[model samples]
Target: MYERQNQRHVPGHTFSTPELAWAWLRSEQTLIDRGEWTPPATRRQEQEAQAQREAETSTPFGAYARDWIANRTTPRGTPLAPRTVSEYHSYLEGPLADFAGRQLADVSRADVKAWWQRFADKPRYRHHAYAFAKSVYKAAVKDGLLDANPWDIDNAARVVLQTPKTVRATMINDLTPEDVQRVADATQPEQWQALVLLLAWTGLRPGEAFGLQRRDIKTSYIDGIPCWRIHVARAVSRSRTPDGIRVDTIGTPKTPESIRHVWLPPHLVPAMEDHLDRFSQPRAEGLIFPSTNEALPFATTQQVAGTTGKQRRDRTGGKVRPPSGFNGARESIGMPGLRLYDLRHWARRILLSAGMGELAVEQYMGHRLPAVQGAYAVLDPRQVWPVMLRCSDLAGWTPSAAAPAGRDTAVLLNEMTAEQLAAAVSAMSPDQLAVLVPTLSPEALVRLLGTQGRP
Candidate 1:
């Protein structure tokens, strides 16, 4: 029950038969077993419960166990999310299936513990499986199928779960822009090309990119130059249903801020437009990078033992072939360590190197501000466009791409806001400021001073 609660599932189910209902009650017995459900039993209440207990103990535990899982639903009342329901089924089939047919009265605490010892060497599974098994017995007691839950014998608070050995945090492989470009070149599919460049260049999360639709990408002007913006609102996920079929699911983003606009640089716009022309769905609400089915993104194909499977996902630590998945494509390009997500990291580093500010980073990356800052500042897309374009230029343009010789830097100083001027001045030490002021031309000094005093 603790594990289920910890996993965000609300535990309760209705059963068809009194016997199954009793076992179902036993499975749900978590609250009482953990001392979270104790209520004083009045004389009449205790007597009535005792009577019910005697009548129900003869029922099979398996009867209720099956219904407990089968009838259970998510809080949203949909069929269980595929992954979640699948885990429950695995537990029931692997460890708890047989217990179903056994009479509630025949089970003992010692028997339950001995069964749990099977996983003692596997601490991780034992801890959770034991907790789940123990809850069933607890539910039995509460349903009047039994007078007491045996697993609670001798005041044992929980199953003795083993702890695994501790280890250091693993480091991720971060790719460079060159590495990202190589993977894009190696990829044969035009859509994957768009997908790879989309993620690497824009720093979008994989699911966020997968969720994008035609209506999400729009043209915007930055400093009078046109660029594209991607409004990310959702992501697509895959789940396996109870009968063993995989299906796509769409849900809320990982965070509220994740529903944000990502700025696409002018350089990548042509490839994007080409991707739309070649692979995009016809309707406005259609997918930008749809799978063969035109709903989810295409699966990463994999070679197997004389066969193939769409389920395989190639990442940094794998071998690849010509028609191989994302990983395979990167490996084919002589840059094997490049994961799609690695491009996101590269995008961030390149943008920061290109002179993007932290505030702009937050918007582009869809990161929420710290609590106090979030309370005070809501991002405005119009306000963020200029910084995004500057960062985009920084990431894409060569040093030689700077403004023409006719443009004057000192004149541009007058365009700086007071806040920008204050930040610039704050970055300079007194000695540096004094030395810098003396070297400035009179006209430049006036422009600088005027900018500093602006409202």
Candidate 2:
């Protein structure tokens, strides 16, 4: 029988979580007091009997791998994005199949080495094979089918290549003031324009933008300072089901820090104020940018009312207008070339180059960290004027030079009305919209309305 506790117990061998360790220790002590336990059987006959039963009843590696993947699903209950278990099944069904019938013990170091050799032969398959095998072993270990993982041995050749003479430009395109105006001007769609403007100014990710709502913005003053805050609540993702049907969904922001509040520039503040008037919906449907259905924000390659016209005409037996509009917007605007995410990259580059501290930008961008010490405290838009002015200069945007110095600041707001702005947004092509939308702040939208001067 085992003693109450080992006389020479290692100092650090206890569990990391006290609750777990204490419970395990209590059970072990009870067993010792009653003399009812002994060390587990390690005999050859015992091993053989266990092996015989497992071989007779244990699931095949391919089958087990699939079931294990299904049971260990994440909150989304889907396999890891960018990968799948069916692919794992293929590997086991092929080269790894021989070991499927053999007991887990029969698999040895030599067998693992041989499989690695075969896996390494195909460069494209090599990474996947290595990852798949590791996952298989891990699952088997959890199920008590293996004593220890032999695949942990690091015995593989490394691949290497030289850096290029000149690195291609990263996502940071080093945009000029004229470049920003040209892109904005070239963009004809209002929603796309707003989306682009948000990226050019605030650095919000495409998915985050897609998930935005009118309520998330808190435009209020603390003490005497004017501040503009954006509270990130959620993001959009796309997935395909087992039947090959595609679905789009929204979930909470990727990380805790991603749920952040960003300060706006005072100049941009007017633009945002005007932007609210322009895009603010009376109902929840008043998303800054809604999917064609007007129920959710935008997603790519989605078929929106692709056959609504035909279906409508068939049902009415006459020329009937469709319930939803045509499905050609995303492709019509040249959005395929400039991914939705490029706006975010462009925003970071603009802010970082204009002298915003790394921590401030990171905080504004919602990057998660272990601690909050390195982050900037939330502040008002007026506090960010220097950075914002530099940003406007970088983007080639200039507020009206003719507004009198003493007039109400609102008089010089963008020259566009909310209705005209909405019309502008509704008329632009997707690509044009992408570039134009990101530039639309409350102040910018008002200025665009021809409200450039006072009475």
Candidate 3:
């Protein structure tokens, strides 16, 4: 019997022999001496706790992981994005499938190592799976289901899969203003021209651009200058459903930093106005870039089949054919591998080259800055307008010249002698010179200034 706090409890187990009872009594006395004595009821409670822990540890890892993902929430207390949930499901079904039958406690470091080896040819997927597994194991440890996390491989989650040198070079290749114009001109249906230009100039993600509504575009006067701004509040995300059907979900932008007002360059304002007038719906709530079915927003992978007049008249269904997409436009312009995302890089490069501060460029591109700077740095439209004007000039963009007919302005500027350039530049007004100054090299500017001082 054990007694504590005026309560007495008897042991539930029966002793088989005198020696066994005496040994148990000795152990209990030893526990008392060490100040570790507990009443019989308290011991029973501890035994129940041990049993519960055992049951939790014995839970199958796959089931635990699925449950963890299902209950996962963002830092803002919102459910995980649908695309994120789908990606986690893919990790479970693909690389982590081998652990389905194994108990949580049975997953050893050796098992993880062996599983990781299978993805030798797919380092990107391997890193993602390793991260997911680490997160799940971390949760298991927190839940008291595991004593320690088994994903102890050093730097396993830090693996940086490098792009091929050739591919990397191609990806970073400078897209000249003429090249962008060419691709936009080559883009079929004519309606997509503004989209191509917007992506290239504004550095908007395709999803964010597609999620735009007429109301998102608003005109603001900055120091008496009319500035058109794209208010990016939402984005369209594509994810595969349980049945493997791809669907688009319109939601908040990728991050809080992505929700911003991107200033439209003066040169592109006309194109935007044209797009709104011709392609976009008249309603404020209607999508700026809707699919052929105007009721639905534009899908990232949507391709409408083109039908000939004869096929339409036949009444027998026209053979489905792929429409000429961005791929066709790129191929037509002799850039077979140029991705639409690459246009964002072009915009960043142009802004940086025109002497925009890194923080300012990051703001323009809707990219998050370093932690301390991100919290404090604010982009003023007054400051952005001057830099944008310079960037527009550097990009060879003219408000009146939407399409280039003669030699490129950049080419013309390059061919002219310092004296000739000075003569030509002197004819321009103060605003034109302000726009032209950032585009000229220091050496060229010095020479032009020297020539201006001469006859």
Candidate 4:
């Protein structure tokens, strides 16, 4: 029965099923407020409630990933860089998309493991998947959506997904002089040859030589010896090129250690000076090697010259011009694979092998000492001359080669003993010596030990 509350003219209602009336009175406010008793639609209500829960639980993984992507779009996206973001997007759209849907909570470890197994065949993709998953999981964990990151489950650090083979420093060290020569020779262009020489001889990166300016070369006295001062400030390489621009650009050196002023070898000094005189524009900031039409001198000018000022006829017109100087000379000589930068590496090795002090070597290379302030204190260049001389002596150039002359051979050989020589030979492993020592003449060995010896 139902009766209206506060009714002057009262109206009453009676239910057919008493159980329904009791159920409605207990659960449904609509009937209870009217003083009526009617049961709720329990079966329909229960089914609808269950459906709502399933909808919440069954949220697609892709949807969550989209949410994550939108959240990171502003903050992380800026720093990710366009190229890096493009790569991440590629992984997401291709590989990761495979597991994007299905509630994250419902994702099993076996499912994750299976995905990894497929990626194992594609090492780069596997690496990208792992990295992307870890990043996403970290964000999820931070948001309190996930209690634990699934990416943290395995030893991701130990995993080595196959990718392109890395070029090793050890391999560079292993390269013999002949190997250097071969690489240099194969490069037909003069610029490549010069670049190789600079890298091998001075250990100057390909870009560093490109960044060199006319004024960077100063005719200065080093160790009381006339030399050229190579002030390293900039680097020019393809890395700095704009997306659409084929012209290479210049930028600051790769590291603080890279910005240095090195004293040129006396023999090389004349050639370097000659090179400057011949090729360098006298303008203060004139690139040591400037492009013919490149407008932005901040980057891209080096041994390679290209006409990219919309003036060149070549379809691919914006390439660095071939190298010049000794590289050109080498090309003329029918030598294969000679590089300009190789001279720098060769020089470093010579100085090191000649027993130059660490500080002196650091100074020679324009490298900073951690203990001292890196700015403005002039030191005597003469103090470094003796070691420099020793380096020149060790290089031992013929009339045809460019190297400084020094103290007589007999004087150098008067310094080592047989025992010391033998001990040195024994203590240094054959492999180590084979790897590091370029050549060991008997006289040089004696000189190195500071005793007269037959070795």
**Top candidate when judged by TM-score against the true structure:** 3
lDDT of 2 by residue, 1-455 (tens): 22323543322344678787777667666855898744333334576778865773355555666566666665545545422444555566666777667655566777777777776657456556656767777878876777776566474434321322222134236445454434544443343545556656787776676777787777764322344677778776665455544456677666566776665544456545665677555554345556644453454423221332233564565776432212222234333233345556667777776656566677778775435554535433332444554465454444343321221222211233443333333333454445455556666665445533432
**Native-structure RMSD, model 4:** 13.3
Q: Give stretches of model 1 more than 4 Å off.
A: 1-44, 47-174, 293-323, 333-338, 342-373, 390-455
Top-down TM-score ranking = 3, 1, 2, 4
Please provide the root mean square deviation of candidate 1 (C-alpha atoms, Å). Answer: 13.8
For all predicted structures, in order, the TM-scores are 0.55, 0.52, 0.73, 0.47
Q: Residue-wise lDDT of candidate 3 within 326-365, one digit each (tens)?
A: 6667767767667777788888876666545678789878
Q: Each model's C-alpha lDDT?
A: 0.59, 0.54, 0.74, 0.52
Model 4 lDDT, full chain set: 0.52
Q: Specify the highest-lDDT model's number.
A: 3
Q: Write the per-residue lDDT of candidate 4 for residues 127-174, one digit (tens) a residue.
A: 766787778767766865656776654765465622212333333345
